[model samples]
Target: MRVKITKTNLWEVALALKILHFADLHLDTSFARIGFSSTVARFYREQLREALKRILKLAQDEKVDLITCGGDLYEHERYTSDTGKFLQGQFENIERIPVLLVPGNHDPYLPDSLYRRLFWPSNVKIVTNAELMPVWNLGEVTIWAFAHLSPTQREAPLNEFKLSDDEGNIHLLLMHASDMSSVPPGKPVHCPFKPEEIHRAGFQFALLGHYHQGRLSSLQASSVNVQESISAPGYGYPGTPEPLGFDESGHHGVIVLEIGDGKVKAELRPISQFAFVETELDISTATSRDDIKSQLQYWADEARGNYAFARAVLKGQLQPEIELDLTVLREAIGSYFRYFDLQNRTYPAYDFSELAEEKTVRGAFVREMLNRIKLATGEEKETLRSALTLGLQAFEKREILEQV
Candidate 1:
């Protein structure tokens, strides 16, 4: 039987549900982009499993009423039978608490999907439909979820989705969707939807996934209004439980949602054991490779280098005769961090004013490149700068091994 809940009588009955929401776990990921060795990659994959274990432990300790995984629980292409068993075992440990999963693009609900091939715990509910389907009705709360039938699902799940007014339960949405308003660069759109569409569909809260940056959107009280309360219904992206790439650098974790006392409160609980750090080092004043190494060491120490997977970009005006060997630098100081990647963005410190006056081919090249750089913008300017550096190296008969 469906029970109706209204704001007028919200306080008359007890209404409390504690939920642990997480997404984008991406277990068994290749970690190829980070350029980690095979051994290191395996270690990171184990870390992801550890993260899931910690999340489950937290849920059991906190006694959450429910647990929702937004999606991308594992990479479908890399998932193995062992991983399937591990997942089943973990979920079974939290057998008392109901667990819901909405599959994302990386782990879609295909015929060969693990969701279909393997038997999950009775308490684990996997959404199998491409459209929004009502999966659970917990008296005062109703959860509607969906799954990505394909890896390239481009349909907007909430386009015309609307719940009937008669269903007075606190409607909630669980899915792997891209919030169109806050998509990062280079991220492909999958199951896109506007934030307003969620509330318009009468859903009190949306537990979302796909984005790797944790975010919570809720109403805020302002001084101008003075009377408005800050506890309006909203949606959130719990992001990835662990840092997947350098682009995902900020706090990555799960969202704890407590619904009671006529209000909903969301809090972020960080559970990532590793950090991805990206920073730039100015090598302008360095005279030798040792000097560059010293600067890198200093930057690493300052940034808490030992605990992070770091990418260092070396940028500055370097002496024309001094060529930086990125491979060598990485070999020298890579041990300082768990993982290290070095990029060279330095330009030759040429006296362009003096070179432009010379009658040599090198001088002519520098002047032309500088003029083009002045007229160019964005990536084009950087391209011209690189060309100039390479041209200078060719004229000097030096080995052009490093990227400028």
Candidate 2:
């Protein structure tokens, strides 16, 4: 993921340097996009292309000497050859400045892989080994990086790295790793390390990649080491150079870092031309189709973001005669936003009084159900109501329980 930067403050007296820090650019193949339905697939491609173009232009405008990418450059190992060729062309645009990358879990280095086999530009350096590889140096500043290409995903206690003198030199540590707690529940468990340990490794700044959402500041635990002077700069996750899915929304871009004479400044640049907006709407007052339509219209109008792909959670009580048409609502939102998910959470308007007085089979069933609900404990009643609600949904094609 390469973090993008448009501008930064310049140091007046000292020799200062600017670097564009980005990471977790999982460039998936067009084939994978096709699996997401045709419209969705095309949307993904557009975001990816726009993000790449933005970062390349940002680098040139910032006059960055080095573009440091944390890791996860590709989505997976199965991208088409044309994808590699396209990346090669993009790399050529910034061939004047060195682009340093460390492989992340998603785009791990494999034997005979396209990343390893392809002929990259001379300015690009792929750090595949685990040892500290000193690559970039200009005017006494050194970029010490460790590429985690080991079979296992996690690296910690960055013991191999010993910062050079703090005088006149900016020591930056670069790698791809996720904080232990941030790993998604079911995803493949990649390398996880404590941020505190990495910070205390004596480096002035520890620029990281892997976790998608951008993170800027953190503190090192006292247990790691006491020798380092400054707390590490936990830069930002470049996110995906593009948005992969609905969850992958909000400020999708890179970070630009300015390090000069022991002082560092970090800024976030948003490249996602499209916005993924997820909002909740209470349909408690909506009685007819037109009422719901007006509410939807207001929501679409209220969508205030760069690009909108919103999902409105429609909740509350629904009228007995009213039935929602999901297809119509999905269409009504239109291409103003790429996608809008109208989730129905409303309960049916059931008249309990009418059923209580009857003696028929259906009436008896309703009476007994009500009696049990009134007599049972709160926990027991809630559990039973859940079962009945699901059963009713199966029978009526909509919710029946009243949510309070």
Candidate 3:
């Protein structure tokens, strides 16, 4: 007997193209700018390599149709031949799935770049063009990509390019461009383009890089939950698969895109083993170094600090008699965390009223500063308080360090 399939059943059986997207692996980074020791730097570099292996394994496990790398796969200046061999082996392991790469500012497509120097797997495709160029046409989907030929690529590849026709197929853009609308503070724009440009280019979605923080555009919400399917034509940044620095503090992962039935859904799969955490610690009631250590320990325990690279900004008033030795504080709780950093922004706790009443030069100075502080408001008040602290430090023969 012959069976007829209903429209709903046909839709259920429709092919869904799954693409696993990630960017900014930045393998072999020295980590020196973040003040990491050589040993720690090497450890982080190894972590990046491991992250790549995990990403490949996830793609295979998910049975993704394609794997896309937005860019900055490694630090061109520091990437060794061994790293290239490692990447080659990892990609070759998933030879059944096609891999697409676009070089970014940090790992541009220079003549000596690994992209050109190494013999990548036959399934891997690297976009070497400095302009928008179609690299793959997978029957139902066409991927357009570009590379940063120089370390300072600033050309906007999307501004002038537009699809001639949709041809009833999904068009995807893969590039390491900066979205001007959501550029991170202190981040330089590279291959800059606006969000509207993605729509103007007539693409279903643009997988992006250059922004360390993952974000989505053209969606009702700015971010998405894991495996929460939503039909939308948008662009997104998968961000770095691992935290490169303290500035990149949120979830670091890969994006899984499923396109079928004329709808596209992106899901974030968090795969990073390490985390970068920043928090503020108020030591207003603390009277000793042990108190600070205890507070840090408590926070570490609460945060599951085993794999955390943490930074605590010490704020609020600190007792005058208790001098904060950052080294001691870090040593006290350093073992509790993988890495710990302390930034002092504390103000000295002073009994202003008592100091003003004393019969001494210091007393007179304190009295004058207190009078000024009372008259001041807003920033002026804070400025006077800082001056008072500095003056007191000078009188006490204590070293005055600039507050961060």
Candidate 4:
């Protein structure tokens, strides 16, 4: 059952309730493959442990009554007893704060899941029930939650369940769901639902997980549902406190919220230790790899992170005759970060107009390749063009063939 709050008593309930919301801890995730080094994996593990220590300290310092983890506390396939014990030990630090959590698709509630097999501290409460259930009633707040038992969960969380009455309690939901409206690229859609469903559910607040980027906002109940209910105060995805890759940019951290009587307040707290950055530079002006190295070095020095693991990409059309010594560029800039991936995605900057005017084999080659490019489709056309331009450039270097 869920309880809804009225506007008259919103502030009182908001003041009494204090929450430390974090999600997608993903402890023991395989960073080894991403970094291609054992030491990097160990480094990432230590970072996760440090983040836990910081969050616990924050909870105690701020006197938060509830510590809510939205989901994905660990990586299911790679989780181990030692790491699980380490997590349990982290929870033991919070003496009185009630830590509530739901398992996400990554760490689903399987039969042999860590949620079931391992023992947690008394203060910890993991919602691993297969069904959507109301597990706790704290004063004026009621929490409805459930765990993802498998990697692919298709149920629409709010649509499948029926709610009780307002009953003067603030209804808060904790679960992992993909916002069908703005699902992040490459993110799996588990427990998918439209935003309108959340608003019509009549919950005072909904704290969600799964997407690595945090987005918090208040949404009013839409008029689309004919059988409508009262509007919700807000919903949010706290995101992964730590970033998993270079693609996840911007500040990363947990959210702190206070709910009482009928009011709710939420704030994001940053806890990023290292910066995962990706910078794309136009290499059309550059003639060699040193230019690329300089551009990447400049970006690294400018980033605000304490430690930077950056991916430098060379973009834009390049001169056909320009040779890029990527190995040299990587070696020069690789020392600036813990990990680095240098990639070149440039096409030859050929002057087709100039080549067309030349009364030579190069001009003839260009015309032939252009003809094929019109008839050829996709990668084959691009490959033929590259081959023709680079080959002509090679022949031009022979000196005797430049005019012909």
Residue 253 lDDT (model 1): 85
**Clash-forming residue pairs, model 3:** none
Ranking by TM-score: 1, 3, 4, 2
Off by over 4 Å in 3: 1-15, 219-229, 350-404
Query: Which runs in model 4 stand beyond 4 Å of their true positions?
Result: 1-15, 31-36, 160-162, 221-232, 304-306, 350-404
What tens digits encode model 2's per-residue C-alpha lDDT throughout 94-194? 88988887877667777755568788988888887766656677665667676656436655525343443333355577777665645645445455565
Tell me the TM-score of each prediction against the true structure: 0.86, 0.76, 0.83, 0.82
Top candidate (TM-score):
1
**Quick one: how many clashes does candidate 1 have?**
0
Residue 147 displacement (Å), model 2: 3.1
Each candidate structure's count of clashing pairs: 0, 13, 0, 13
Per-candidate RMSD, Å: 4.3, 7.5, 6.7, 5.8
The models' CA-based lDDT, in order, is 0.83, 0.65, 0.82, 0.75
- In what order do the candidates fall by lDDT, top score first? 1, 3, 4, 2
Question: Per-residue alpha-carbon lDDT of model 3 for 277-380, expressed as tens digits?
Answer: 88899999998978888888888777756788888899999987676788777777788778877888888888888889999999999999999999999999
> How far out, in Å, is residue 366 in model 4?
8.2
Candidate 2 regions with alpha-carbon error over 4 angstroms? 1-14, 29-36, 148-152, 157-168, 180-189, 218-234, 248-250, 304-306, 351-404
Clashing pairs in 1: none
lDDT of 2 at 105: 69
